[model samples]
Target: MTKITLNAEARSDLGKGASRRLRRNANLVPAVVYGGDKAPQSISLLAKDFAKALENEATFSSVISLTIDGKAEDVVIKALQRHPAKSFVLHADFVRVVAGQKMTTSVPLHFINAENSVGVKQQGGEVSHVISEVEVSCEAKDLPEFIEVDLSNVEVGQILHLSDLKLPKGVQLVALAHGNNLAVANIHASRAE
Candidate 1:
């Protein structure tokens, strides 16, 4: 996983009015960094810079190195608020990360060789992905940007479940035993004309 560097400034003001003012004048993004033993600190970041950092899909789950007033901190994005009409970021929540501690995050899934799968090519079947991402628990450094699912030999009517995934080293899926049925992909038979 790669780290995104963002510079933030501590904001002492609170409330909707102050946030709106910041957005109107400076084009700043109101955000909060919480978690760990420290109290959540309210901060503001440049809207353009923050938007650039968020351009990557992995930004939501990947570890970020935040530089606040020259001090660097390891954190992960926990939540985001975007404008309903324009889709611009309105607020963001970040969680502080501690080394050696396990973190839970949803990692994106990428399918490979789906077009070449025997089920689709030979059996006239269609591949349907049930889950586009899965929640995983692991050390921040062990987090994978995306999990690849292979469909080379999947046959029609076969369903790929969470247990069938081959996770990276040190990564573990977070789920109850019964939840393992969460299907990742399925091959459906196609109708003949």
Candidate 2:
């Protein structure tokens, strides 16, 4: 996995005005780092650099090395707020990650061999995805950016449940932990007009 690093500065100014100034004057995005054992710290990240890093889909799930005031902290993006109409990032929230400690995060799912699935190819069925991502709990070291679901053997009228997912070592699906075996995807026969 590729590691991502973001440089930021600790901010003393707080409130909507200060944040507005940072964004309008400095083109910076306000963010906060919370979790672990330390108090939450307010910081500002460069909007240009942050936008570049966000271009990669895996960045959200991967561990990010955040350097604030020359001190580096391992963190993950817990939440992000963006402008509803504009393509601008307004605020970001990060959660500190401690090694060997378990954390829950959503990981993207990739369905492979769907086009060649028995249901679609032989049975003239349509492939449908019920969920594109799943929440998983695991230590930082065991975290996976995405999960793969093989659909080559799936047949028409068959639904793949959460239990059918093959999780990586040391990783557990959050839904399965609570006994929620939700359907992830399925193949259905097309209706004739």
Candidate 3:
């Protein structure tokens, strides 16, 4: 709930050709907002503003206040298509945040105390991150900025799965709930000569 807001305008032009023209002519990014009880709406946002808003990593998981033509609504970023060779975003997809409803979004994982962990500091082990982010299901209010994985207690040859990390209240890992039990990080013996 970081009061981040992006100003947007409804776009009537549809299809791939129109989207290309919009990007080339006006430097606007085409986006769509779907989900909840309302029908999907096509919109356009300023390229610079869109890029600026996404500069913060938390913006991807936190609830965003999207202002469209003076009207405001809460949303969560679902997907983003970036240019293959460029750093700019080409298209964006968002899901409308409905009160009392669960929304699934990806949040970054923060590994703490890796350098001073039992594996690295005491056992000459190196940490390997298998995944950097995880998809979670929770209400907008329960959405976490990032999940923290503590490596201080970990030992060499230990692979911490998604369920090993402590999640916040009202937050649940989507993969864990489905029995995926993905490995988030691990500590292994150093291969350096």
Q: Of models 2 and 3, which has the larger TM-score?
A: 2
What candidate 2 gets wrong by more than 4 Å, as runs, is: none
Residues 144-165 of candidate 2: C-alpha lDDT, one tens digit per residue: 9899999999999999999999
In order of appearance, the predictions have TM-scores of: 0.94, 0.98, 0.97
Runs with alpha carbons beyond 4 Å of true place in candidate 3: none
Locate the minimum summed-lDDT window of 10 residues in model 3. 1-10
User: On TM-score, who's better, 1 or 3?
Assistant: 3
Backbone clash pairs in model 1 (N, Cα, C under 3 Å; residues 3+ apart or in different chains), count: 0
In terms of TM-score, which candidate is strongest? 2
Q: Write the per-residue lDDT of candidate 1 for residues 77-123, one digit (tens) a residue.
A: 88889999999999999999989998887889999989999899998
Ranking by TM-score: 2, 3, 1
Better of 2 and 3 by lDDT: 2
Worst 10 residues of 2 by lDDT: 1-10
